[model samples]
Target: MKAILFEAPGSDPIFTDVELAKPQSSEVEVTITAAGVCHSDLHVVSGDWDIATPVVLGHEGSGIVSALGPGVTDLSIGDHVVLSWVPSCGTCRYCLAGRPAQCSLVASVVAPLGVLHDGTSRLSKDGRTLHHYLGVSSFAERVVVPVSGAIRVRMDAPLDVLALVGCAVATGVGAVTKTANVQPGSTVAVIGCGGVGLSCVQGARLAGVSRIIAVDIMPEKLELALRLGATDAIDSSSTDAVAALTEMVPEGLDYVFDAIGKISTTEQAIAALGLGGSAVIVGLPPTGQHARFDPLALAEADQRILGSNYGSVVPQRDIPWLVDLYLSGDLDLDSLVSARRPLSEAPAALVDLAAGHALRHLLVPSI
Candidate 1:
């Protein structure tokens, strides 16, 4: 199968052919239809994250189940599914506690080694093992994912659109609705206008927030945010984002989201909150980085600083609901798809994404 091989950090991904092994007893083979070129992929490629080399780099994807493993009885061949990076073992402590995103096996095993729960590589090139990225390396034409990572969705759902829901949509919208729990008619501001950030704006709208403020350094992105559902937009490159937001909501916003994952933005999200407000950090910053905040202010004002991973989402429950929203014409998945290109163009697409030139670029393998 053809795959994008990231030989190492600080180098461009090379388009090459790879060998895929059959699915294990707990896994399923998927013929990938579409993969989203997300910033998280770029983070790995750019060495922002300490990921292993000679790996297939992508996580957000939608595809059809090509083959089912021995123990995989719930899914059948030809089932359309959206892939999620966080695959949970149902019996784990976190899973039993209703937080599958923090599944012990996924966090402690699969992610660090870039392998399956069994700690083995399913991909190879020229007789050498190639690592998997996040257990669902969607950059390849086909992938062997654990059954838990593949969430079955409507077969009629557009694969390209569902591809975004796997990550960006799930993370962005989940951050607002599930994590922050923004109340209706509340004021909210989202920092960063990338795909995830824009989805936060849309999520706030869906939650019936009256004042949805979008902040970014790019003017074009701010305009796109308005079209999606932002009631106000601010270009942080020209003006002070914190000061501007403070002026808009004199008592500060009821809720704020930091989708950029920068130390600065994380701080701003907390500082721009009103009394009893919550600031949810949705972006994944590079490992080992930390943000500083005033504990006195948090206690005195009854404010909260929360961390949301994968939008604190439960894939099986949320993906279908988001699909319904799309089918009903409430969630605008079409506008979020800025460009679509073949698998060969993925390298360039990553460049454009890092340059802030594209919204949600889908790499269509079949096309």
Candidate 2:
């Protein structure tokens, strides 16, 4: 199978023919149908993460089960599924406690691709091995993944759109629905309007927020936000975002989401919150970078700061629900896909994504 391999930072991933392993007991082999090129993957290829070199980077994806391991019974060949980067071992303390997203077993497997509880990789290439990023390496045509990492869903669900469930959409919607627990009639502001940010805007809309303010430096993004569900748009580049949003609401917003993982945006989100309002940080900034905050301001405002990962999404619970959302016309997945191309063109898609023109791009990994 042909897969995208990141050789090093700033280098275009080389598409190479690689041998794929069969499913081991408790694992499943999937034929990746569509994969989304995400900022997270960019962060990986750009060396923004501590991931091992020559790793297969994509996480957000949808696929069909090609084979299932000996012990796997929950899913089988022909079952369509969405891939999750964070694969949880149900026996872990977190999983047992009903917080599968926070499963410790997943934390242990995240960094290295040629890893699992077994300490070996199912992925490898030309004598060398490949590591999995977030358990499911959707960038490849087929992936040998743990059963815990793949969520079985309706085969009829539009495979291309469902690909977003693996990452960007899940993170954005999950942050609003699970992390912030958005309240109806609440006033919400979202900074950044990429895939995740746009989903946050839609989440706010779905929650029935009274006011939805979208903020970003790009006019095009803000425009897209409005079409998605934003009640108002702010060009932070030309305007003082804090001042403008504050002027519009006076008391600030009930919820503020910083979808861009930068200290400045995080600070702005914190400053734009109303009393008792919560600020959700949804972006993946460089690891270890800290944001300075005024202790008195946080204290006096009774505001809260929350971190969201994968939208606090429990794949089994959320992916199906999102499919239903798409079914009911409650969610817009088709619009999120700005372009589609063959896997060989994925590197160029990455370039376009880096140039900042799309919300999400899908790679036909197997076509």
Winning candidate number (lDDT): 1
Residues 259-282, candidate 2: write the lDDT tens digits: 999889999999888888898999
In TM-score terms, candidate 1 sits at 0.98
List ranges where model 1 is wrong by over 4 Å.
none
- Cα-based TM-score, every candidate: 0.98, 0.97
Clashing pairs in 1: none
**Candidate 1, backbone clash total:** 0
Question: What is the lDDT for 15 in model 1?
Answer: 91
What's the CA RMSD for each of the models? 0.9, 1.3
Candidate 1 minimal-lDDT segment of 10 residues: 153-162
